[model samples]
Target chain A: MILAIASGKGGTGKTTVSVNLARAFDSEIQLLDCDVEEPNDHLFLKGAPTGREIIGIPVPEVDEALCDGCGECGRFCEYHAIVSFGTTPLVFPEMCHGCGGCTMVCPVKAIRETAKPIGAVETRRAGNVTLVQGRLDIGAAMAPPLIHAVKARLRRDLPAILDAPPGTSCPVIATLRGADFVLLVTEPTPFGLHDLTLAVEMVRALGIPFGVVVNRVGLGDDRVHRYCGQRHIPILLEIPDDRRIAEACSRGGLIVEALPEYRGLFRNLVGKTMFRTNPKEA
Target chain B: MKVAFTVSGGDLAAPLDSRFGRAPKFLVYDLDKETFEVVDNRQSLDAAQGAGIQSAETVARLGAKALVTGHCGPKAFRVLRAAGIGIHYAGEGTVAEALARYRAGELPEAAAPDVEGHWA
Candidate 1:
C-alpha cells in the first residue's frame, strides 16, 4: 500500500514525520520525495544516490524550410507558447507544456518533437529504506512533470511512503495521486488549521481516505483538534513540542536514531496507520 | 505609413493606455488616407500568459509601421522590432495628442524595451 504524507501549510513537520515513520518501520519500505522544487528528505536521510537519471518533456520544434507558414501549430497550442503572424512561428520554450498538440495540428508536418531537460531523479539507499527524490533544474517551471518522474520510481513489491510538497497545487496533487492512504500532517496553529481545512476539502474531493497527524502539539491553541473532532477526522498521532526533537532535526539527525525513546511512538504510529488501511493483515 | 496607439477607448481623444499588453483598445491610423480604425484588444487583456506576444502578433498582422504606448516589454519589443515596427513612448496624454507629438518628431524612438516582461 502507498501512503502519502502531505501538509497544505509550509513547515509543519512533513519531512520529519516522513523520515521518522520510514525509520520506525521494522521491515523494508520505500520513500519517494515528490517535492521536486525543494527536496529535503536526503538531508536527514544521508545516503549516496545509487542511481540518477535525467527527466524531461518533449517540446515542439518547428522547421522553417518545410513549407508555408499556415499558423496552424500556433493556433493549436493552448499555452500560447508558439504564435505566428502569417510568418514563421516564434516558440517560447519556457511556456511550452510539452503536450505535443502543436505537432499533431500542423498541416505541413513541419513541427517535430524535441527533448527539453526539466529535472533529474535520484535513487538512494539508507538501511532498510530506499529514498527516491526529484531535483528540478533551476528556472524550470514544470514541477508536476518532475513529480511524476519521482513517483515512477515506486516499487510495487514494498510498501511506499510518499512525501508530498506543501500546498494544494499541481505538484502536491501529482504526489497524492494513486495513494492508498494519505497522512495529513499539520501543527495546531491558526495557519495550520486554515490550510488543513483546505487540504481536507481537497482530499475529500479526490475521494481519498485521510487522517491527521498533529505535530508540535503544545505550541498552538486547541483549534485544530476541535475542528478535527467536529469533522470526525481521526487524529492518528501527535508529536510533542520538544526542544530535543528540534535540536536533533537541526543537526540533520533522524529522531528514531537520535532519540530512541521516540522510536516507540513512531513505531506505534506505523502500527495504527497500517491497521486502519488493511484490517485483515493487521 | 500606418501607426498604432494603445488606447483606453475607440476614439483618438481617449486616454492613452499605460500598458502595452493589457491595453483595452488599439487605434491604427493611416497617415496617407487620414483614416483610423479601432482594434479591440480585450482578448489579450485576459490572456493567462504571453499577453504581450499576442498583442504584438495583432499589431504585426495589422501592418502597423510604428507603435506608441506608455511602456513596452521585452517580448513585445522583440516581436515588434522583428516585424520592422518602431516603438515610441508617450507620457500621460490622449491618443490624439500622442499622435500629434509623433508627427512633430518630438517623441524619441525607444532603443530597447523600456520595461521588463509582464510589467503591467
Candidate 2:
C-alpha cells in the first residue's frame, strides 16, 4: 500500500509521523520524503545517502544571433514567461513551466531547450526502510518537478510511504496524487482545524481515501474531533502533547526510538491505515 | 469593467449559467457587452492542477478586468493581481449567480486564497 503522510500546516509532525511509521513496519519499506524544499527525515534517520541524482527542468534559451525577434516564440508561449514585441525576446526562467511550447513555436528556431538544475534527489537505506528524498536547489522556486523525480524511485514491491510537504498546494498534490491512501496529520488547535477542513475538501475533491491522525491531541480543543465526527471521517490515531517526544524530535531522534512504547502506536496506526484502505485486509 | 469568471463546461446553459450554484471550468465574461465566453481549458497544454495561474494569465491577457472562481492560490492570485485583474472567491456556484453577486456587490473583494497547497 502507498501511504502519503501530509498536514495542512507546517511543523505539524508530518515528518515525525512519516519516519516513525516507516520504522514501525516489519517488512522492507520505502520512505520517500517528497518535501523537497526542506527535507528533515534524514536528520532523524541519520543514514548516509547511498545515491544522488540531479533533477533538471527545461527552460527556453534564446539564441539572439540566430534571427530577429519575430515575437513568434513569445506569442506561442502560453505562460508569458517569454515576452518579445519590438526587441529581443526576454525569457523569465522562474515563470517558465518548461512546456517547450516556445521551442516548437519559434519560427526561426532561435529558441533552444536547456536543462536548468532545479534540485537533487538522494537515496538512503535504514535497515529495511529505504529513504528517498529530494532537495530543491536553494534558489529554485518550483518543487513539483523535483518531487516527481523523488517519486520516480518508488519500489513497487515494497509498501511505500510518501512524506508529503505541508499544506494543500501544488507540490502537496503532486506528491500525494497517485498514493492509494493519504494520512492527514494535524494538531487539535484552531489553526489545525481550519486547515484540516481545507485539506478534507481537497482530498474529497481528488476522490482519494483518507483519514486523520491528531498529533498533540490533548493540547488543543475538540473542534477537530467534532468536525471529523460530523463528516464520518475516522480519527485514526492520537499522540498526546508529550514533552519527551518533542525533545527527542528536536534532537533528531525518532519517536519510536525515544519512547519505544510509541512503536506500537505507529504500528496500530499503520494497521488502521491498511484496514481503512482495504477493509478485507483487516 | 470587463470581468472573467472561470466556468467548467463550455457555453452557458441554467444550473450551469451561474457561478454560485456550480464552479465554472473557467469563464471570461465581458462586463460591458454583458456577454460571457467560455475559456477552453480542456487542452493539456494549459491545464495547471492548482489555481491554474497560467490559465488565469491567459484570461487576463484576453482583456479581462476581474476573475470569478471557486478558489485560487497565492501564485495565481499574485499573477492576476499584477495583471490588474480583480479576483472573487466564490465557492461552487453557478456562473450566473457569481456574476450576479458581483453585479449586486454582494461578493467579497477577491483576496489571495489561503496559501495552502493543492490538497488544502
Candidate 3:
C-alpha cells in the first residue's frame, strides 16, 4: 500500500508528518520525497545517499550548416521557443518544452535534441527506511518529470510513503497519483483552511480517499474542527502546538527518535490511516 | 514606410496602448498612402507565455518598418532588432498624434528594450 502526504499551504509540517510516519511504520518501507524543487527529507534522515543520478529534459538545438532559414519551424512552434529571421533559428532552451514540433517542422531537419539537466534523484537508507528524493536545480521550471523519476524508485513489495509538494498543481498531482490513501497536512489557521479546502477539492476530483492531519493544532481557533465536522472528513491525526517538536525540527532531529514518547502516537496514526483507507485489510 | 503603432483600438484616433506584448490592436500606418490597416492582437494577450515574442512576430509579418509602443522587453527587442525593425518610444496619446511625432523626427529611436521581458 502507498500513502501520500500533501498540503496546500507551505510550512504546514507536511514533511514533518511524512518523515515521522515513515519511521513508525515498523517494517521495510520506501520513503519518496516528491518535492523536487526543495526536498528536505534527507536532511532529517541520518544517512548519506547511497546512489544519485542526474535527470534532464531534451531541448532543441539548431544546426545552421544543415539548412536555410525557412522560418517554418518558427511558425509551427506554439511556444515560439525558436524564432527564425532569415538566419539560423535562435533556440531558447529555457522556454522549450521538448515537444519535437520544431524539429518536425524544419524541412531540412536542422533541429536536434540535446539534454538539459533539470535535477537529480538520490537514494539513502536510514535503517529500514529507503529514502528517495528529487532535488531540482534552481530556476528549473519543470518538476513533474523529476518527481516521476523519484517515483521510479518505489519498492513494490514494501509500502511506500510519498511526501508531495505543496499546492494542488501538476507536481502535487504527479506525487499523489496511484496512492492507496492521501493524508493532507494542514495548520488550523484561516489561510491553512482556505488552501486545505482547495486541496480537498483536488483530491476529491482525482477520486482518491483522503483524510486531514491538522498540525500545530491547539494554537488556532476551532474553525478547522468545525469545517472538518461539516464536511464529514476525518481528522486522522493532530500534532499539538509543541515547542520541543519545533526545536527538534530546527535541529534536524526526527520526532520519533528525539522524543520517543510520541513513538506510540505515530504508530497509532499509521495503524488508523491504514484501516481507514482499507476497512477489509484491518 | 509602414509604421506599427500599438493602440487600444483599430482607428488612428484610438488611444495609444502602453504595452507591447499584449497590446489590444496594431494600427499599421502607411506613410506613402497616408492610410492605416488594423491588425487584431488578441492572440498574444490570451497566450499563457511568450506573448512578447508572438507580438513581435505580428509586427514583422505585417511588414512594419518601425514599432511605437510604451515599452518592449529584452526577448521581443532582440527579435525585432534582428529583423531590422526599428523601435521607437510612444506615450499616452492618439495614434494619429504618435504618427505625427514620428514624421516630425520627435520620436527617439530605442537603442535597447525599455522594459523587462513580458512586462505586459
TM-score of each: 0.89, 0.69, 0.88
Report clashes for each candidate as comma-separated counts: 0, 32, 0
Give the per-residue Cα lDDT of candidate 3 at A25: 85
- Scanning candidate 1 chain B in windows of ten residues, the lowest lDDT window is B75-84
On lDDT, the leading prediction is: 1
lDDT of 1 at A16: 98
lDDT string for model 1 (B1-120, tens) is 999999988898899998999998899999999999999998999898888988988898888999999999988887788778899999999999999999999988999998988766
CAPRI tier of model 1: acceptable
lDDT tens digits, residue span A63-96, model 2: 8888587878767776657766445676668777
Show model 1 residue runs off by greater than 4 Å. A278-282, B1-3, B7-17, B22-47, B58-65, B82-84
Q: What iRMS does model 2 reach?
A: 5.2
lDDT of 3 by residue, A224-271 (tens): 889999988888898889999999999999899999988888899899
lDDT of each: 0.89, 0.78, 0.88
Isolated chain A: TM-score per model?
0.96, 0.94, 0.91
In model 2, where do residues sit more than 4 Å from their true spots?
Answer: A275-282, B1-120
lDDT of 1 by residue, A1-282 (tens): 888999889899899999999988988999999889999999998877799999998888889898377888877877778877667887888788888898888888989989999999999999888999999999998899899888888889889999999999889999998988888999999999999999999888777888999999999899999999988898888999999999999999999999998898899889877546452221
DockQ of 1: 0.46
Question: What is the per-residue lDDT of model 2 for residues B1-120, given as tens digits with 9 covering 90 to 100?
Answer: 677766556654433322221233556677777786665554423345323455554666678877766666655665566667777776656667777888998877765565443433
Sort by lDDT, best first.
1, 3, 2
